[model samples]
Target: MPVHNSDIAEAFRRLADLLEIEGGNQYRVRAYRNAAATVEGLPHDAARMIEQGADLSELPGIGEDLAGKIETLIETGELPLLEEVEGRVPEGLAEITHVSGIGPKRAWKLYEELGIETIEALRKAAEAGEIRDIEGFGEKTEQNIIDALGRFEGGEKRLRLMDAEHIAEPLLDYVREIDGVKQAIIAGSYRRQKETVGDLDILVTAKRGSDVMDRFVKYDEVDEVVSKGETRSTVVLQSGFHVDLRVVAEVSYGAALFYFTGSKAHNIVVRKRAIDRGWKLNEYGLFEDNERIAGKTEEEVYEKLDLPFIPPLLRENRGEIEAAENGELPDLVQLDDIRGDLHCHTKWSDGKFTLREMAEAAKDKGYAFLGITDHSKSQTVAGGLSEDGLAKQIDEIDELNEELDGIRLLKGSEVDILENGKLDFSDNILAQLDYVICAIHGGFNLSREKQTERVLRAMDNKHFNILAHATGRLINERAPYEIDLDRIMTEAEDRGCFLELNAHPNRLDIDDARCKMARDMGLMVPIGTDAHSINGLETMRFGVAQAGRGWLEAKDVLNTRAPDELLKLMRR
Candidate 1:
């Protein structure tokens, strides 16, 4: 099996986590973490780059030593350094970090101080009243840990939707190569564009002579074949993602796709609708009196049900069926409708690229504007810019905008919203920029009332124009800090400020439901890549997918407007 970029990135990340746990040199551990981020966000496969004799070290953060490890991992599916560290570190020590409230330092402390290495041991200690005795942990923290462990226990490992796409897209491409395959699409939550996916369901239509099932189980990435039949098969891929494939006749293709691409609740509604119309709907076709009425296409299937074809992303039974019936379905935002990206970083902060390079990349993608919202000084680890440093960077953006054509660079800062609801930079400094993207960099542990007040107070700042990643979530990694988003949305509406749908795969904050809430509240939610590197701009697709699921139309997004109009809107 080919070693994917995700594999190499995971190896580097593990090495970093283990090194951090051991209190290794900060720079060395940071280098590994940085390399992991750089490799994971690459637009092309790192393994393919190595195979083409391209220099891996040319990529950002990849020094010669790290490059060699990446090459070794890709070539042999193992990293020697990682293996050596795994031997020294208790393997389960890493697993402990998966619990919500227990970071690496805490995990290491639990292991050394309490002899609690595995989650089982940690749970026992927490339950036994021993965990609260630790220097920093209290009864609250101990209970939180126990609650987190309870959540983790018996949980099925799931991948972020984009990660599933990483495996699914390539697998679908391979399946399409079968001689008789006519159509193939991976369905289920993946098709619905959920933020995370449990597994994949692939539906295919092929000619009578196809051997697609055999081809599927024989794919190079298949770790094991769970089951197989002439028309259906289940296999676990090397990445531990389970995939099921079913081939249907051309006449039944649409019905199978609709059945398998369901949120079970949504399917139930559709089936009830079919029954109301004296029709039977199943994987085979939509039938009346045992005679097929429609099945050849999804459009036909919905047409028979007296509804227009619903986009897969909006088929969550969340008022979509009702909306379709009432002719109130939204025209969800599209990738092409995006006119600019308003939140991104550069080497001025923690980004890998320079201002001009980022501008050029956005321009290449047909964007009219790109906002340089690099981190402000409170985010020390990202090397946030001081006020003086931000002034100089703003001047550079001014120069770049003049020299560049077809794209405008907006001067901005991702200023931290401090604990007391103060902006990181002075109002005078913040007002000089095109806009301000205030965010929470620290103090994620505030009370629900305090957190909401902090954000609302920040929004009240005269310079505040957008809230970057409003929820501060890292998907499965960290839960959103306790804040009343309903209150935040109301405040944003009153204040004329917008919210961001941070497009980074790991931080698709202001989730689909919130996005829908923003739309209903008449808030302008722009999709920003928050790109640290040029390649990060490609993450816009995920954000667009997320927005579609949220039922956002082009008009609901601020950046969908032309540059001039967007500037005016942001100022509102």
Candidate 2:
């Protein structure tokens, strides 16, 4: 058996919990949390070392007393300390201690009184209104548990991208501050800039990895420790999302990160390239003759393999490696190149800003124009406008256009494509608008074929200038309804309608892959930050970056055109 430090660390972890129950120093109790992290991130097995005659005291977080306890376990095959505590306190009580509204003292009280040991029991008590009558838990507290129980019962524990950032950003900086940590980068979907993230994956390089993971598990934000092992540690944040930290040596930092933070397919292509050139690839690096060579940074990894550094989004294995090897990778888009937003809503619909305020904010960002695409009448829930409402809004747009010198206000509507694929408004109404981005707001359950046909019909609509949020994926939660993207792209190419890359994080439609496919068909894409508020406009940066991953150039995007040119293209 690889002497599992996690098994040993967990034993000590129980004592640490008991210490909290006995009202021990908060910092002393924190030592066990710290030890858990240290054990988790050590690249080499400390338990094996302890078995091989290395003292546990040599480990950074394991103190003399903790070391003695580890020694005792190695000799006697049992931890008297943890077993004694287990005798007094019920087994698995620490596990129950993580319920959101329940603290350590309350958890101990439950064990001493009601003998609650699992989420099910707690839910039953709370739902039966037994918890509200507990000393510290009030009606509000009881209600909070009831709600959290619904979440707990559902077996869903992922964090939203926004929530993950709230925690990961600070810890990322803190890990960098540690003296031994040479490099750290966020891997996984967060790095891909997905609108929704389940958990955060962080990769770090350190001379003191054992010390680092120990410090990491106590990340001030971590509410519960999940597992700790050498070179890896997993923890649950107060928000109930798990974050996995992997520690590698400084020398292999880049290669390890590139491998671990993966879309999987991207790594396969890169490794195939190495094999073609008589090299083997792994987290450490490309190796030949048992001698490590190639890659100290992500850029170096690509350069050594003779290719461009692929961005996280492009790493989805969409022929980028082959294209790069041939020196034919399309010029990817960049954040700075974006100069305008075309799909935005205003208070006229469900947007938070007025038309002028949204436009002026665009101007401040140095954009040349703003397209006000408020929801059309079919979207009643969003206060979608009728013909007269649109006309009134257009008048305000005209007035705003006059107030600005160079910037133009586009009179546009995100008209609903009724189930049959027709625009919400009549042709006369559509003709009066500068552009129409017809979208699907309902009929989410349509079969893939019907959905494709529905969108195809809208794409061929003479007045429809863009097929907005094609597939309509809400990232992490909603699977985009199946659309024969081939048919939609084919129809889009036949007509001159631009494909909308809705830049709202929740809807970065035409995602990275579809954008490449569309560009391959010579269809122009318009990367629109479907900005509904000033802050929403910031998503344009990711939209642009996502396009870059697909090797998109400015010419490939319809929004890159000047107002007159864009108007002409939309009219086409």
Cα RMSDs, all models: 1.9, 16.1
Lowest-sum lDDT 10-residue window in model 1: 148-157
Clashes of each: 0, 5
Query: What would the TM-scores of all predictions be?
Result: 0.96, 0.68
Pull out the clashing pairs in model 1: none
Which portions of model 2 show Cα errors greater than 4 Å? 1-163, 194-196, 207-211, 227-232, 276-278
* Predicted candidate 2 versus true structure: per-residue lDDT over 1-572, tens digit per residue: 12244445556677777777656787778777656544533333455577578776766556798788777765565888777867877665565554444657887776666768777787888888887777877887788666645433223535434445545676799888876887788898788765557787889877753388788887766788899887889998755667888887767777887887787888888898899989998989878869888657778888888888777766777777777878777766777677688988888986767887888888888888888999999898678999999988988888878888767789999999888988898888788889998888777556689988888877667898898888876543355665788888877777877788877655678877777877778888888877656666766876786677666898888888788888987787
lDDT for each residue of candidate 1 in 244-322, tens digit (9 for 90 to 100): 9999989999999999999888999999999998989999999998999999898999988989999999988889999
Could you tell me how far off, in angstroms, the CA of residue 196 lies in candidate 1 after the best superposition? 1.2
Best by lDDT: 1
> For model 2, what is the error of residue 232's alpha carbon versus the real structure, in angstroms, after optimal superposition?
4.1
Whole-model lDDT values for every prediction = 0.88, 0.75
